[model samples]
Target: MTEKEKMLAGLPYQAWDDELVILRENAKLLCHQFNHLAPNETAKRHTILSNLLNIKGQFHIEANFFCDYGENIYVGDNFYSNHNLVILDVCQVSFGNNVMLGPNVMIATASHPLDPVARRATEFGKPISIGNDVWIGGNVSVLAGVSIGDNSVIGAGSVVTKDITGNGVYAGNPCKFIKSI
Candidate 1:
């Protein structure tokens, strides 16, 4: 299988593969243009995002949004992201309806192997799924292979390392369960 196929399958892949490098460069260029678009060019922004990602319904992402492999990211209806949103979508990153993300929210699917030798050779990724009606606050770093269930809220500055089930507020570095709504 090709390196991109391995990446899509959530397996270890050579990050420096020529095709993947070209894809990343293309995404970066598109993101750069989207980020630099005039504030009045709302329709163009929407068009760019629609072309860049697998999206549905009405959505808005503020300036300075960045992603790797825009094709691997999908956002559902009524999605909104604040400024400085960065998604490292080495694997699929899917978001359900009505998801909102605050500024500087980093959603990453890429990770390195624990073995030093392997880490330098190949990189792996896991999918991240965010269910409906989830609100993620600012400066939240979501690691690979995490699923945030429906009606969940992640507090600002939280580092999410594990799966978060629905109907609760999660906070802190390790992301603990707070009150349930």
Candidate 2:
């Protein structure tokens, strides 16, 4: 299998492979263009995002948005994200409909090997799934392989490292359930 195939399959693969590098570069360039556009240039921004990600229906993302391999990221209908949203989508990072993200939210699907020797040689990633009607507060970091179920609210400044079931309020580092909504 090709390096990209391996990467998508959650298998270890050389991140610096030519194909991967080119894809990342393209995504970066598009992100740069998207980020630098005038605030009132809604049509242009929509055009760029349409080319970059797999977005469904209505969506709006504020400035300073960045991602790796935009094709691996997907956002559903009625999605909105505040400024400085960074998604390191080495593998699939999918969002369900009616999701909102606060400023400085980082959703990452990329990870390195624990073994030092193997870490330097190859990188791997797992997928992240966010269910519908979820609201993630500011400065939240959702790590790889996490799933946040529908109708949940993640409090500000939380670091989510595990799956969160739906219809609850969760907060704090390593995000624990607070109360059912």
Candidate 3:
């Protein structure tokens, strides 16, 4: 299968070493479009300057956002991000309706293998899914293969390394459930 096909399938693949070069080139073109628009263009340009990857009914964004591929990331209606939202969407990053993200929040779906030697040669990405009405606080980092369940809240500056099943508050460096709501 083609490399893009493998990526779409969520299968492991090598980054082809030149991925960043291609991304840089594409980013320049996309940025130019973003910069030159008159504030109503759709279908490639961002919905709002402050808000990057918004679907209909999604709201504000305060800081910069970097996405590997914008089309692979989909946000549901009424989504809101505060600031510094970065998504390394090597795979699909889907958000349900009414999701809120605070400052410095990162949602990553890319990860290297555990072994250092293997890490250099391979890249793996699992889809990151966020259910409806979830709230992620400032400075939080979400790792690969995670799903934040519906109605859950992630505390400030927490690093989420695993799945959270919903209806609770999660915190800490590795992000553990603190209480259920």
In order, the Cα lDDT scores of the candidates are 0.96, 0.97, 0.76
* Candidate 2 vs. true structure, TM-score: 0.99
* Candidate 1, poorest ten consecutive residues by summed lDDT: 43-52
Tens digits of lDDT, candidate 2, 1-181 = 9999999999999999999999999999999999999999999999999999999999999998999989998999999999999999999999999999999999999999999999989999999999999999999999999999999999999999999998999999989999999
Candidate achieving higher lDDT, 2 or 3: 2
Model 3 residue 178 distance off true place after TM-score fit, in angstroms: 1.2
TM-scores, each model vs. reference: 0.98, 0.99, 0.82
The reply for model 1, stretches above 4 Å from the true place, is: none
Put down candidate 1 lDDT per residue, 22-75, tens digits, no spaces.
Answer: 999999988999999997999999888888999989899999899998999998
The parts of candidate 2 lying over 4 Å away from their true place are none
Candidates, ranked, TM-score: 2, 1, 3
Rank the models by lDDT, top first: 2, 1, 3
**Root-mean-square deviation of every model:** 0.7, 0.5, 3.8
